[model samples]
Target: MSDDLIPGDESSAADAADAVYRELLERLGEAQPQPRLGATKRALELLGNPESSFAIIQIAGTNGKTSTARMIESILRAHGLRTGLFTSPHLVRFTERIGIDGERISDEAVARNWDDIKPYLAMVDAELTAAGEPALTFFEALTVLGFACFGDAPVDVAVVEVGMGGAWDSTNAADAEVAVFTPIDLDHVQRLGKTIAEIARTKAGIIKPGAQVVSAAQHPDARQAIVDAAAAVDDPAVFEGEEFALVQDAVAVGGQLITVRGRAGTYPELYLPLYGDHQGRNATLAIAAVEAFLGGATQPIAEDVLAEGLTEVASPGRLQLIGTEPTVLVDAAHNPHGAASLVAALGSYFDVDEIAFVVGILQDKDAAGILTTLAPAASGFFFTQSESERAIPAEELSRLAASLDLPASTFADTLDEAAEDARRWAEEAPRRLVVITGSITLVGEAIEVADDREWKATA
Candidate 1:
């Protein structure tokens, strides 16, 4: 096909792409999660099973999935491989979820690929309707689109992050060669399960027969579930702090320095340009996962390549510093465990005497649990809600904080107002900090507001 004969002109491609994205958003209005592999499987089969064309690594857990997936993609790309990365709940652009060769897929590519797959998607919709099943969901369609894009890119490997629980998640349509699990917690109790063991069992479903499984140290119940799952599949399983470990970590200027005892060999003095000890642990898991993927825990990656990959790793909306001089940091800490990690990282890394938090949370999350975890480090709170329909109202959050005996104020407006209020509170003192957190959507909004206000880090 000639360039002139394309569906839209170059200047109009963005609008065309956005229209396609809007159609995908319309699928979310139903919100009826078809948590099964059937829809995605059928869709991919129609697309010629592009997911199987490339080597796949699947990462699943309550948190750190996106960060670990990014790390794995970066390390694999550093090793001179073309890598495709599919992550969920993008901070900004829809295109952020799909990456090829270390960069997000372009809007033009999104438009072109959607056009190419539209017919096959329609076919799947018809098939599902005939079977008295609902059509493909927003996530299911997106998963199929990502696989098709990866196949078109002809990437050597693809790092895929599960959107939710691993078993029957849309991405599970692809059998991964490597299955990685981060810490499993009690966040998504309504969908996954109510207990740690139940959640771990749901997550362990990602481990396929003959696939290598790498996991973080877990609670006893969670650990047993993973071990049992691996045993059932006859797969080799490596757990952090046992098979591989983060040997040492110290706070550095911009981020942290760590040494990892990988399954293959001990890697020392790796500079990870991200904060938090949890991140250091995540880096160790990423290294071990890469080691497992390349070879079975015995072959070592080149030191320089590993270092370069770690240096280039970026996990935005996760304790990301957006501004300084009355410093502003944004973290997507929606649950108690994540909130505790945020508070710990703040205490260990930054020198702020006090912190004012701009907090927003989803309706289903444990607001009291999060506030309690954050209470130790928080000097004040600015409660707000993100754009998500599921977010709790700011006044409700403020009331919850009051019950918890935490000093709180309510923005009851936009996240921008909450962020600015927090910033003003921080500006009153020389070494005060403003932290925008509690939800990923809130952190994303804070970042956008910071960018618009030209708020650069002055430190």
Candidate 2:
């Protein structure tokens, strides 16, 4: 709320660019469930179809898409290929949504691309208005920017994480060489569909002719939908537990080491620095995707490269331990399934005397379902709101937490204060932990603050 808190460029001042972005998203939400791909198509046309400039890997799922895309990008780079990764719902910086060879797109680069694309965005809006159609959405504009950035980066391959569902998502403009699915579930019901079969049908829209498809183990209906989709295009399909699987997974002091046996070959004990047993499945899916994309290459990837690449990749806000002694675990679990995974990971991986949580859910998410899963594991709850306006108010979230019989407190109207309170509560208990979950917006804000502090110290 302070003037100094606003971001600025040389010519223009920032009055909550974050707030402006959130407002745009809110406006888009007012028009949600518009599953038509026209806006994306129009935006791509105005931008000269930049997504076609490179080979692409399209990844889609209800959960784990970001993690899987990051892993696959890392694996491709490990093979000595220049890779570009485009993902969504960034935890911290907007530049995190687009990266090349593990480096985030520079702020200057993003600003430059924004300048380059602004006029096209205006034209698209004008055209849509002329046609009496809804204007380009925040996600649609951002997806165009992603394509432009990747086109400018000019990497050999671009790994795109589908925003929302795969079929009508803006990123679907690109013809991907491979399509990956990571355990589809019922999350985005309104836009995608109500049932698993219907949702799978929408997600399966990303599959193109002759593209190799690699999917994690799926619900029966979902799996059948994917099968039907691939068969329609004559695509070679690899399914987890049938064509590939995690043969073994073990945790150690360093991190998780998982052996993934794909249809092509068995990847032995790939050490990933990420925590959680769920990550084992993610790593296996990444490996399977890489093998499918490589098309049976005779040259084997060096063990050192695979191990080093897997171990070194960074996935923030997914069971990240931010503070020691009264430990703080920050995870972006925005839905029931994700919250369940976090609960399982916490119980299996960390040993602590007590667990406290700073929890908040957005209006669009499953608040009751998330709380139902998290409250059983959490000893205390510090309910708060994310920076997003769509965030459910703290009092409502507190009431929801009360339904679970969890000791809960609603803190100062914001996530930062709630996180501080959680930290304070954890400080009082021996071997205590404070976890932040339920929304990526909260995770992003927390990580941005941590990074800013680190930079100030070094500055």
Model 1 weakest 10-residue run by lDDT: 1-10
Best by TM-score: 1
Residue-level lDDT tens digits of model 2 in 1-459? 223332445222233334335544643552253566777777777788888778899999998998898888888897888889988887865667889778987555566666677788888889888998878777777788788888887788999998888888878877899999999998878777899999999999999997999999999999999999999999888898988899998887756879878766677878788888888899889888888788743445567767867987878789886665556778999999899899988887888878888887889888988888887787878888887878899988888766767665565587767877777787786888888888999887777655553412221
Which ranges of candidate 1 are over 4 A from the true structure? 1-11, 29-31, 457-459
> Which lDDT values do the candidates have, in the order given?
0.88, 0.80
Q: How large an RMSD does model 2 have?
A: 4.3
Model 1 agreement with the true structure over 1-459: per-residue lDDT tens digits: 223335547656767667778989877432356778988998888888898889999999987889899999999999999999999887877889999999999777887788899899899889888998878889998998899889998899999999889897899999999999999999778888999999999999999998999999898999999999999989989899899999999999899999999988999999999999999999999999999999966699999889889999999899888887668889989899999889989999988788889899988788899999999898889988999898899988898888888875666578877777788788887889888899888888888888888789643
